[model samples]
Target: MRFLLIEDNVQLASAIVERLSLDGHVVDLAPCLADARAHCATAEYDLILLDIMLPDGDGRTFLADHRGRENATPVIVLTARSEVSDRVGVLDLGADDYIVKPFDFSEFEARCRAVLRRKGGASGNRISRGDLKFDTLAGTLQVAGEQIQLRNRELRLFEIFINAPGQIFSKSKLVDRLFSYDEDVSENAIEVYVGRLRKHLSASAANIVTVRGLGYKLEV
Candidate 1:
């Protein structure tokens, strides 16, 4: 998963980035709310790890602006503020979860995973289509209990398909989904990822079919 870490504490922010990177996440760190908002303008992040006391702006205001204008990107607030009201305030401001400073890294990671799982779906954090079950958070594709691991792009393509079910997703939209502002994506990149995911699915490829010149759609 690709994540954005909006934190001003250089030491703690580096530590968190290292930990998350070791756990198989591609992380981008921003020291202030301005940099974070700039990244948000074009980059697509799976989740955002935010700090309340930013150098340039308040995290609450940033969260409000984002929720009001953009896609509902899951956010977990990391702050030194430990008061009951502080926690309530952040949560009420649209944060997916809140964690106080001097926290256990293990628990923080667990909370991040839980928040992502809940936002994605149920059924044991899996997206099912007939005999296939894809564990999105774990990035595992299981066919009748046989597990298969997917590459980053392949998993991302599958994620889009599973999220919409039967709806048609245009190639342009898929390209936008697979790429961040930091990356240069061609129009055909979507087709490339879809082709790779189709090969990975084998017989299950029937579930994802082209919609002629329009794009692609997933059918149960």
Candidate 2:
């Protein structure tokens, strides 16, 4: 899943980004309300991890604006404020969940997984296109009733493609989703994985096709 994290603390932001990335989520971070709002306006995200306090404005104000636009993207408030009124305000303003600061990372991850599951994303962890199916948990692919083994990178690439079938994703976006934020893997690496997956897919390769001037899309 893709997540937008809004927090003014640079260190905490970095840590959260790293941890979420390690859990196979693509995270985009913002340090202020203005930047967060701009990102939310332009990009598609599965969830938003918002901090109530920001340098430019209140997270509640941004939440109100997002709500006024009728945006239904789920939000989880991660903030230092744990007061009852603050919790009520955020939840009533349309946040999906709330996590107070100095919280356990394990709990945070669990809540994230739960929220995503509620969004109907967890069931499709195994991606299917035509006669091909990739079980993300087992890291195994089955084609024409034959099991096909894939390398680590190939599995990651196929996982991303299969999850959002028919959605055109740029090479950069794929790279960001496949690798951790700290990794320096090149854009061309995606092509390499695509080539390998195509070889394994053979005639079924048509399901994963290039979009002119765009990127790649997995046709269901």
Candidate 3:
């Protein structure tokens, strides 16, 4: 999954980004509200990890504005505020979940998965298409009950496609989703990953099909 982390705490943000990346999720960090808004305007994220006390403005304001625009992107407020009123305010503002500061990383990760599952209409960590199974939590792929190995980029590409099966994804969108802010990537890099992933999915019941001047979609 692709995520935007809006946290003013540089150390915390770095640690979270590293952990999420290790778990096979692409993450972009924003140290302030202005930067976060810029990221939101240009990119689509599966989730947003928002801190309440941003350098420029309260994260709640950003949440309100986002919901005001009728944007449905799931947001989990990560803040030092443990007050019931604070939590209620953000929840009423359409934040999907809330996490208090000095929390366990395991709990944080679990909450993230729960929110994503709820958003994707999935019940658990595994998402299936035909005979293929993707272990979202474990970052593994299985075809017909047999495990299939994929490179990091290939796995990331597969995750995006599998989660949104039958939906067309343009090359530009794919690039945005596959790479983080620091990576130097191009459209050709996306094509390379797709080509390799296609070969890996050869035995599966699902196939990735190009849409001819449009993009690619997963067919099952």
Every candidate's lDDT:
0.80, 0.79, 0.89
lDDT winner among the candidates? Answer: 3
Winner by lDDT between candidate 3 and candidate 2: 3
Candidate 2, residues 105-169, lDDT tens digits: the string is 98998787667656646564465667887776566898767798776677767766776778999
RMSD in Å for candidate 3, one decimal? 1.3
Candidate 2 local Cα displacement, residue 13, angstroms: 1.5
* TM-score for each model: 0.80, 0.70, 0.95
Candidate 1: give the clashing pairs.
Answer: none
Please state every model's RMSD to the true fold in angstroms. Answer: 3.0, 4.0, 1.3
Whole-structure CA lDDT of model 1:
0.80
Candidate 1 residue-wise lDDT, 122-178, digit = tens: 535677877788886688888666788987778767876876788898887676666
Weakest 10 consecutive residues of candidate 3 by summed lDDT: 148-157
State the lDDT at 205 in candidate 2: 43
Residues 141-194, model 3: lDDT tens digits: 898788977767787788788878999999999988878878888899988888
* Span of ten consecutive residues with least summed lDDT in model 1: 174-183
Deviation in angstroms for 175 in model 1? Answer: 4.1
lDDT of 2 at 72: 85
